[model samples]
Target: QSNIIKAEFAEIGERYNDKRRSEIIPISGDLSIEDIIADEEMVVTITHNGYIKRLPTSTWKTQRRGGRGMKGAHTKDDDFIEHLFIASTHDKMLFFTDRGKCYWMKVHEIPPGLRTSQGRAIVNLIGCEAGEKVKAFVSVKEFNETDYIVMATRKGVIKRTALSMYSRPRKGGIYAIEIREDDELIQAKVSHGDQDIILATYRGKSIRFNENDVRSTGRKTMGVRGIRLGTKDDYVIGMLIVKREGSVMVVTNKGYGKRSDLSAYRTQKRGGKGVITIKTTDKVGNLVGIMEAIDDDDLMLITDRGIMIRQAVEKIRTIGRNTQGVRLAKLDDKTYITSATRVLKDEEENEEEEAAETEEE
Candidate 1:
C-alpha cells in the first residue's frame, strides 16, 4: 500500500514540475590563443632557404662590433641567414615576395628553437606559390595613417603606399606592387612621411630623395623610377631610409665597407643619375648592400657561402663618399658578401669580451 502511495505521489510531483532552481547564465566568450600567450621580445631569423625560427633575446651575448658572431643557425653550405631582427611576439609581420605579393603573420606564430637549430621552412607557415620567394618583410605593432610602406625593385623602380591601406590581409596574398617582366621586388621599408630615402645600386651608385617626391599609389600600380641604372646588368641592391643623425654604411661583394655621413650624400631628384657611393675597382668588387647605422649599432654581414660576422659599427672607419672602403670581412676568393643589416643594441644586456665561435646544436 505504501509503495502504491509513493508512486502516485511521484507522478503528481512530475506533473507539477517547478522552474530550475539554478540559473543558467550566458558567458561573454571563450579564451583565444593570443589572450593566453604572453608577448615577449624575440630574436627572429630567416634563412635564404626559407627556414625561420625565433629564439629568446638572451640567446645572443653582446659582443664588441667586429667579432665573428656565434653560429646563429645550422644552415646548409648553400644557405645563410638573410634576415635577423628583434621583434615583439605580438607584432604583425608583413612579408613581400619577389613576385610582388604580400603575405602576413604574427611574430609569435613562428616556431621557437635553440640558437643552433635549423628552423622550420617558411612555406609551411605562409601561402607561398611554387616559384615565389620572400624578398622583404616589415614588422608593425599598429598601422598608422601618417606612415607609409616604401618599396624598391631590382630594376630601380620605387613605390609608396599608405600604411593603413594594408591593414586587411588576404589568404593567398594580394599585390603590394605590380612587377614588370624583367624586374623583381628587392627591398621594402617603413618610413615616416617626411624622411629622405636612399637607393643603392650594384655598380656603387646611390640616389637620395625626399619621401614626398614619390606620390602614394594603389596596391597594384607600378612604381616610378628611383634611379637610372647605367647598364642592363646593373641593378639596385638595397634601399634605406635616412635620418638626420645616422650614417649610411655601404658594403661591397669583396668584403669592403665604410660609413659616410648623411650630409655627404646631397639630396637629389627622384629619377637622376646618382653620385658614386664607393669606387668599384676589382679589389672592392660590386656593391652588395647598404644600411643606415649609428655608432652604437651592430653590423651583420652574410656571405654567399653561408658565413656571417657581427661587429660593432663604431669599428668601421667613416670615410668620404667617393673612396674605396676598408676590408670589413676577411673573405676567401670563392666567397663574397651578399647581404648586410644593422641591429640596434639592447640596453639591458651586458657586453661580453668575445662571443663563442660556434654554438651547439
Candidate 2:
C-alpha cells in the first residue's frame, strides 16, 4: 500500500510539474526526492533601467556566469552594485559605486532581514533625500605637506594656520560675534558704555573709571598733568634772595634784579668808588637787559653788599648797562676783545730818546 501511495504521489507531482517531489529537477540538473527549496539568501539584481529581476538558486549562478545577473556585479567597466541590501537591524547604510564614489545614509530604524526588493521599495515609498557627498577615506591626522593635491570640495578644508584664532559672525543674528581657533569656537563678548577709560597692566589686570575720578587739579585732561603726583610742586614761578649789603633782589619772568633797592646808591660804594656790572647768567644771549659776563655765563649779580650770588638759570635775565650808560655788548660766540688801548708816557722818555737819536742815525 505504501509503494502504491508513493507511485500515485509521483504521478501527481509529474503532472503538476512539481520539481520538489520529482526525481529529476531540469532547472538545476539535480534529483530532488525531497522538496527543492529556493536559496534563503536571495540577491536582487537591479538593471540600469531600474528593473529588478529575482533569480532562484539554480538560475542565479547561470545568470552570473552570463554577465547579466547584477547591474554592477563582477564587472570591470565601473558598473558596480548601486543598490545596497540593508537589513532591518542596520541603522546606517554605506554604499560604494564602481567609480569610487561613496555615500553614507543614516536611518532612524530599519526593518528585520527584509528582502532587498522590499527594502528598496520601502525606501522609495519613504522618499528620503540623498545624503551629502562624503569622502571615501578618512584621515586621523591633518595633512601638512603642500605637495598633496587637495580637492576643493572636500570637507574641513581650511586656509588658516593650525590652531590660529579667528573672529567670525554668528548665524541668525546681527549683533553676535564668534571666536574660533583651530575650528573650535571660543567664548567672548563686548559692550559699550560712557566716557570711561580702562587701564590694563602688562599682567592682564585692568582698572576702569570715569573721567571725573581721573581729572587733573588744573581742570585739564588727566593725561596733560601726567601720572605723577608732585609735578605741580616742582614748577618754579619766581625766586628771591637778599644780598649781604642789606639790598633785596627778586627774579621773575626770566628777568634778574628787576626790583632793586640800590637805585639811590648806584654810583657810590661804602668806602670807595665802585661800579655795578649786571650780566645774564647765560653765556649765549642777553638776559633782562644784562650783558652776559665772561665769568658768569648763566647769570650773576655783583653788588656792594660784598656778596656774589647766582640765580636760577631760568630766572636770570639781563637788566641794564654800566655806569657809563652804554648798552652792554651782547654775549655771543663771535664777540671777543683782542686788546685794550693804554696811553704811553713821553715826558720822562724825551731826553733819553733825544740822546739815543744823536748816537744812531
**How does candidate 1 score on lDDT?**
0.87
Question: What lDDT score goes with residue 28 in model 1?
Answer: 89
Against the true structure, candidate 1 reaches a TM-score of: 0.77
Task: Please estimate how well model 2 matches the true structure, expressed as its whole-model Cα lDDT.
Answer: 0.25
Cα deviation at 53, candidate 2, in Å, is: 7.7
Model 1 bad stretches (over 4 Å): 1-43, 47-49, 55-89, 114-116, 343-361
Which lDDT tens digits does candidate 1 get at residues 62-84?
87664555778788876667678
Instruction: Report lDDT per candidate.
Output: 0.87, 0.25
Cα RMSD of predicted structure 2: 45.6
TM-score quality measure for candidate 2: 0.15
Task: Please report the candidate that would top lDDT against the real structure.
Answer: 1
Worst 10 residues of 1 by lDDT: 349-358
How do the predictions measure up, each by TM-score?
Answer: 0.77, 0.15
CA shift of 262, model 1, Å: 1.4
Off by over 4 Å in 2: 1-39, 44-59, 62-126, 130-153, 156-361
